[model samples]
Target: MADKQDLNAGFTGTPVEQPEGLAKAAQSAASRVKREAYAVTAGARDHPHTASALLLGIGIAAFGFGYLLGRSSAESSASYWR
Candidate 1:
């Protein structure tokens, strides 16, 4: 046990080196994401009615699926008690 060194004793604040091209690839990916997000926002703004209708449909489908799942679980537990 005496031979073990403290874990924090070797710590240094220097930035770690990254693989070549990793930084450039990350920057390009970020820019692509930003462009896509901007395009989505512009499209939604240009077609508010379609976006709202799509959102409403998604909400209804999600609620129905959740309701079915909950109902099935409740029925199974009730039957187990009997």
Candidate 2:
């Protein structure tokens, strides 16, 4: 345990070497993400009606789910048996 601690304490904080291929892969992934994001944004901007309908549908679904959960919990917690 003492030797392990000494070994850990003697190490200098030097950065580890990374392969160039990893950097290239990361950049390619980032480029693809940026392109996809731009496409989505452009599509949304071009089709406001579709985007608004989707947003409204999602909101209504979320509200309905929350309302059901709240009602279930309230019913379960009530002392009807007593």
Candidate 3:
């Protein structure tokens, strides 16, 4: 029989020593599971400031786009008249 080490393609992380405690923790967590239990859930929802902040961002983008377009048009018009 190929030793278990050879069976694994090449996983080097620490192998399990006590499965009982890990299993107990997993069971308890599963029963009382919550979406916010994990760190990745930090920014998973829209908060109070998000709507207004997004509106402000979009407004700024529109303003900058209009400013750039107006500048370009004025430059072209001036060059055409020169």
Best by TM-score: 1
Question: In model 1, which residue pairs have backbone atoms overlapping below 3 Å?
Answer: none
Worst 10 residues of 2 by lDDT: 1-10
Model 3: lowest-lDDT 10 consecutive positions? 39-48
Cα lDDT listed for each candidate: 0.88, 0.87, 0.74
For candidate 2, give the lDDT of residue 75.
Answer: 92
Cα lDDT of model 2 by residue, 35-78, tens digit: 99999889989999998999999999999999999999889878
Q: RMSD, each candidate, Å?
A: 11.9, 12.4, 13.1
Per-prediction TM-score to the true structure, in the order listed: 0.59, 0.53, 0.42
In the range 1-82, model 1's lDDT, one tens digit per residue, is: 4445545576577558653598779978999999999998999999999989999999999999999999999999998999
lDDT of 3 by residue, 1-82 (tens): 8997578777678768755787879967885676545432454343537756777999999999999999999999998998
* Candidate no. 3 TM-score: 0.42
Q: What is the number of backbone collisions in each predicted candidate, taken in the order shown?
A: 0, 0, 0
Residue 45's lDDT in candidate 1: 100
